[model samples]
Target: MKPIFKLQNRKLIVIFGLFIIAELGIEIGFTFVSARTGFYFVLQFSILMATLFILFLIERSMNRTKQELTKNKQKLQNIFDTLDVAIWSHELSSDTLLITQGIEKLYGYSLEQFYEDKSLWKKVVVPEDMHIIEEREKKLSIGEPITSTYRIVRPDEEHRWILDRGIPIFDAKGNFVDFTSVLFDITHRKESEERYRSLVESLPDMIAVISRGKIDYINPAGFKLVGSSSAAQLIGQPVKAYLPAHVLEQIENEREEKKTFEFMLNRLDGKRIDVEMSAMPILYGGRSAHQVVVRDITQRKKAERTIQFMAYHDSLTELPNRYRFKQHLSRILNSEGDRTVAVMFLDLDRFKIINDTKGHTVGDQLLQKVSQRLQNTVGDEGMVSRQGGDEFIICMEDISKEKAAEVAQRLLDVFTSPIAIDNQEYFVTPSIGIGIYPEDGTDEETLIKHADTAMYLAKERGKNNFQFYSPELLDVSSRKMELEGGLRKALDNQEMILHYQPQVELETGKLVGVEALIRWLHPQNGLIPPAQFIPLAEETGLIVPLGKWVLRQACEQNKAWQDAGFPAIPISVNISVRQMDDEHFLGSVTEALEKTGLAPRYLDLEITESIMQNIERSTDILSRLKELGVRLSMDDFGTGYSSLSYLKHLPIDSIKIDKSFIDDINHPSNQGLMVKSIVDMGRNLNLALIAEGIEKEEQVSFLKRNSCAIGQGYYFSAPVTAEVMRKFLAEGFVSV
Candidate 1:
């Protein structure tokens, strides 16, 4: 059947011969039919028709078979064309190859284009990848199956990547026939890998891949840190070269705990590295491996040490801080044997005056200079520290009480000469206090407290001096602290009250106004004077709040008196130097007036001449108060150091003569004429003059003669409560 299917010419010859035979038969039949019967001719025609129909059926069947074969072959070709992978085959004997149209999709080429030029494969392949293709083909020809990757240049000159896998084919005789290969377009995947490779190469941390206990790959950062010329120089190196036995032990110890370890690594140039390492198990290069990340921590360690130093020392002066000082003192106190240690507390007097007058920049430089002098004075025998602010502490060991005094004197003597700062000379006087261990106190806190108390004693004796701690000074401080505590509780407990003293016109004997004063009534103790706690409030910054409270109550009470149908005499409230300069002073005054609905004209702010210390600030504040329609009076007039130029510039409506000048108005000393001079000055300035502390008619007579009209003292009326003052105002214009 196979031979017959192949016999094309023979089949055609057979068909022609059959047709001739048929023709001869038909002719003979026709000759016979002419002489024979009609039945014989009809039988011969039927036989010829039967033979023709059978031949036509065979031809139609063959044509249908041919069409089916063509359709099936086209279907197979379509399947190959649809595949994403190119299926190709090479016949080594003919040196020809067959490829699916998928090659057109993979390499931008058609089957004809590939076959039309036998050298097309080599021509399209990039020069760099040509050897890879040759090697892959050689492997396939030798019956060695292989998978390779190479780049190709398309017709448009664009480079594309291909993954070619070759499988050898064999005949029944076991001889290599050809090779079948499959190609996949891996351009996108290769491009993605190249991007990631670029990113990995740019990392700053040392990243290394270890496989089979050997260094397999490392990034550029890793190569640089290891002091290698190229990545190849370190590849395949044993891990033991970097991580020694001790380092491995450290890593093992940290594995379960933190997954990180620290070690010093030596570079190829022999420079040691302080680094922290973290490792994770990973599968790399087709095997179990470890990915290690190393970060250099030398700078971090240096920063930590700097922070530690900053914690215990002052940044500005570079002296031991309070914490370090206390620690040192504590160690000295806790010593086994009986040791004589002196803790000296030295504070510079008038420091704030200098600091506020000259800016903080000059103050800071001055402090640095002072610290240098102190360090030079103390040397190594004692530890000196800037406890903070303008205060310094000196710790001396095995020193006698007399030696403590000598050291304190030496500290004071260091500042006798004025030190120049920013081209300005500043004279500093230090008050030093000495406390001896086991004598003044046994512990650190107790000794420190005693030293502070003695420091105050030196300031009292006169600044620029020294004093040893005495038990009596401790008692005084205890009482002072107790008073401060009571004062704080007094405000909250409603134990504070205001008292008003009537001011009267000297000759007319008519009520002018009253001064409101604060008095504390202790629960256990009797009435406490303002002199006892006012200074404490000023020192501790409590005056700001206390002054606000006082001002509020005075305004509200005066309003209440007027509401009760009493005469609306102006009640004066004393404004302190600190309060006048306070940031919230104006706000407090405004709030009090708004809250109490008190008219501003009925309120009078009385200030002492001491406020002239800061003349500009005082003038500004007074002008603002005057704008509110409140009257301003200068109290204790002759007591301050303000010049006549400043006096004329003040916004004061009146001047209150100092009680000191009035007390000795009739004295034989200069006081007799001083009161008259003040009166003349006030009159000349067109300012009203009021004299206070007039206890006698003679004092009143003197003031009246001096042209001073208003007077306030025990002669008029002592300070009384609000209720009493209300009765006094209702009666109207009382005289002493």
Candidate 2:
């Protein structure tokens, strides 16, 4: 407005100068022509012409200036209407207010309404925001520029956030006169800010903003995560106080980019927690900063560690498993420099028998106790691990065969003192086999295999002993494996047959019963002895099916002999410990008798004294057999460590003196005393007595003198096929 005023002033000055020039020209012309004519007449005409010319020029210039002012005012109005803002001014002198049409859009009011009510702008302000308008007016009155934000409610009841920027207009003397202001609507921006604030505040994870080196802002979760009671305790605190120095350096180095890291957070409570923090650059309060989101992962980390431990350790024994043992052995083999490393495979002898008889609960408890003792004995000298079930493997580095033997002896000695379980003491022993590195083989698998083979050898050599790997053991192991493979297929091929040995009445020299024995007629190996493959079958768990086949065959054969018009007599079949431990043993016997139509009294079931280890269960089984009307006999009596106190409780009808005692009767070491004692006991108990392995007449004579009436040995007839035994039965008697 001042520039336009100055331009008008300049134009007015030009007009005055032009009038003066015109007056001067007229006066000079009159002065030159005054001498030739009448001076007064010429002067009057010149004055009139000069006056007309001045009026014409003044009209044109004034009209051009008015057009330009009108054009400028229209341009200013267009600008105000095009923008999303309202431009207005207050006139102090007339107390009048003027505004453009833009006010209608900003405040939802028309120009006429504002003019009718001069205080309409103040009335539209929300009650809570009226102070903003008052403050703006006070600042403007003091000749100051003011920028303020306030809320307003329009006539339509719509609320809006407004930004008012006003500059005070003053006179040349600096007295405040009026003010001009621009009004803008910022409702969308304010709503967005509120939404962002709510989102940050409601998050479960800690959200923090770091500016410079200090914490500029922290959410509620952030305060809780750091164990701070209030925001004041964290805001403006150095981030380094909570984050380690190295972590802070890493954050600083990656400040411009997004990064995630796992670190230990130092809480205000002097405790540390595992946390995962993700940081990224953001603008906060119009300055560059980092926004970090932190999550606690302590529980997840602990769970991961537990899973790792379970992968390599046994659950029940809490010892390293087979995989972990192999890994350790491989590491030692790879790192050692010609040092002897020993891998000893230890198997608890008779564990299956104990487990089957005593219940798996006691077996599990016993295993745990054994593993603990093994570890204590091995100490730091080696690594002891469970190879599943009752098997354990130990790996020792920098050890010789002699040292390994000593270690194995120590392990065996640990079980010397009975393990007390359920208030009962049990003596469990181990069969240990040691295979040395580079001596047995160069690799883990080979060493473990050789050690396993040697362990089987120890069991064969009589359990509760240790054996080192030798080349001869491999041949024995290979042969044993071959026999096991053949044994599995023997029953399927019908290569298995039963042979009967005559059980003679010593007084009459007459056949009273026959003991049935199983033999394998291998196609390639001819007849395989039972001793070579029976243990293999038992160990491989093939005995369950094989024993079933034997029972069926023996029952069927005895019934066939009876159908053939032979003398009626009980046929005895040997039952293994494995068979007795079988839950279906009773069922198998019942099925055999039912299928073969063999009378229960004609079938005699012979059980070894070894079954007495589980005396209560043995008594139950014998009582059930007695209830079936079958004859029960204790085979190999006086050979096993059966308790005499429990023997009377069994429902057995007879006791067979073991062949070992019978073979030793002729010895002079008072060995006959043992047989005499067994015969006397059997008679006193009213149980029939039988002497096995009677190869000489003197042995029979000695047995008959002791009143042991029944005897089965080569002295009468060796075990023979069904036809040969039938011929012997036909003869019906043998000379004593």
Candidate 3:
């Protein structure tokens, strides 16, 4: 297309030329115009047209350049609006503000509003930060670059943190034109700083930061630990002042390797404490430094020491226990002190009886006093240690045979003085056994074993005296160990059997019941009686499982007899106190009856009178048995702590008069009177009275006279096999 400016210029040229020509023509025709006048008009008109067209071309080019500039400016603004940061420019002369769309997103205002209100930036500055903004504005006016962090209150009344960086713009003559600023929302960053500061301040453990070998930061807790009232007191001090010598040397490792360590800290107040610490490299004040965390471990250290002590020492007596004692003895024997050193093993005589009769609390008090006396008697003479239970050991150094005997005698003399405990006076004596080094045995284990054996011998020889261990005692010790091993294998070896003895009614001479007796038929030792292994079982806690086996066998045999069309007589199974105390004793009994298909009534549990010693526990256990429809009998009545007071509280169906009273039936004494009284007691309680050890017919007659109905003794029949009992049942009688 031709230029519109060109077309207009061409028309103006044509008109101007035509007008001039007409003017010339008119002049010639009328001879009224001169040549100078026409020439001047044409030349002036040509000059005017040339100047006008040049102005039109220049105006058109300027308009096109302005449109291109507008398009580029809009594109730049769109790019700036998408940015998260706010960008703005201010004209110095007019105070006019030009801002991107991001300004509205930041301040909740439109760009037009910012332009209309020149003071919008100043108004948004929070009151507290207004001075900072004003100071930065002054910097901008001075053509200086400035950066600042300040709080701004948005139009919606929300406060935000902003980091503003502004650079000054200058004209050609160095006059300030305007300042451009970029603002980044730093609200989240500021909040995170506050939270981090709060956590560091509130920590219980001390935290510190070290920079350039100086303490730059410390938490409040760290200040208190160092006996300082404020961080100012410790900051800028050499880090070595607070750290231990060794830990100070390890600081480099902590920084480079992130090492954690423990040290004994030296406080400013001249006190020492245990501390655990960790250090890692971190940025502090824009410089690489060490950040350390420390924790006070003084109490934890004390607890650790306490646990260590308890592990090796007896808690009750506060004396070195078996483990610690062995350690000391082993060390002494391993060294050169072997010639004259003596190891003495001591035990309190009949301590279990004291515990059971006087109650464990009193027994504990008695043991404490005994331990004190032992300690006093052996003061500076040697070390005394407890070997658990009622047993104790004394190691005497540099003592000859006679001196060792003297020490043992001194120990015995200490126990002669009765000690009072719990408002009651009790006498406790120690049985001491001395095993002299190089004489009794060599090593610690040997010496300790010999001493223990001698202690047992002393007890056998009527306790309260000390005796030296001899080679002869070793034989007995070996036999006892061998017996224990055999007993452990008895159950698995099928070497143990239950023999049932008939219990006959004195009134009708008819068999009424049978008591199950456990006998060990050893492969080589022949028959072993209850007197031998029963006590061992009680001591070793084997009685529980052994008694359970007895119950099972007795229940099965009695059930078999009843199923064979014989009279169902209750078979009594003897339960040791150990079995009664076992947690699963009832469950074992129930399982036995269930497996045997025996009626609960036909299974009788016979407990000794000692069960009444712990009457509360016995009551609870016996009541559970009663609920199972079983009968309970107190075996060996009139023995132990068989107080009639406790007897009335027991859940028993029968009371078995002990053999001792029945054995005295023919004596010319009041023996029958005691039996009759027990019989009368049983009658009053509606309990059956059975006599034990009725070996004579006169004893049976005496029991009949005393109204005791059931009698079991050798006169009827000794403990026999189940088949023999079955034969007796078939005959419906027993023969001596």
Please report, in order, the local distance difference test score of every candidate based on alpha carbons. 0.82, 0.86, 0.83
Query: Which portions of model 3 show Cα errors greater than 4 Å?
Result: 1-83, 87-102, 127-146, 155-158, 166-181, 224-234, 252-255, 266-271, 336-338, 357-362, 478-531, 537-573, 577-621, 628-736
Between prediction 1 and prediction 3, the one with superior lDDT is 3
lDDT of 2 at 462: 91
Residue 284, candidate 3: C-alpha displacement in angstroms:
0.7
Stretches of candidate 1 above 4 Å error?
Answer: 1-88, 96-147, 152-160, 165-192, 210-216, 223-245, 248-258, 263-274, 286-289, 334-337, 418-425, 481-532, 538-736
Clash statistics: count for each candidate: 0, 0, 0
Q: Which prediction has more favorable lDDT, 1 or 2?
A: 2
What TM-score would every model get versus the actual structure? 0.57, 0.64, 0.64
Most accurate candidate by lDDT: 2
lDDT of 3 by residue, 239-353 (tens): 8877876777777555566878888877889888998999888988998888999999999999999899998998888989999998988887778533578999999975765
lDDT of 1 by residue, 496-563 (tens): 89999998877777787888999989998879888888998888777888889899999999898889
**RMSD per model, one decimal:** 13.6, 11.6, 11.1
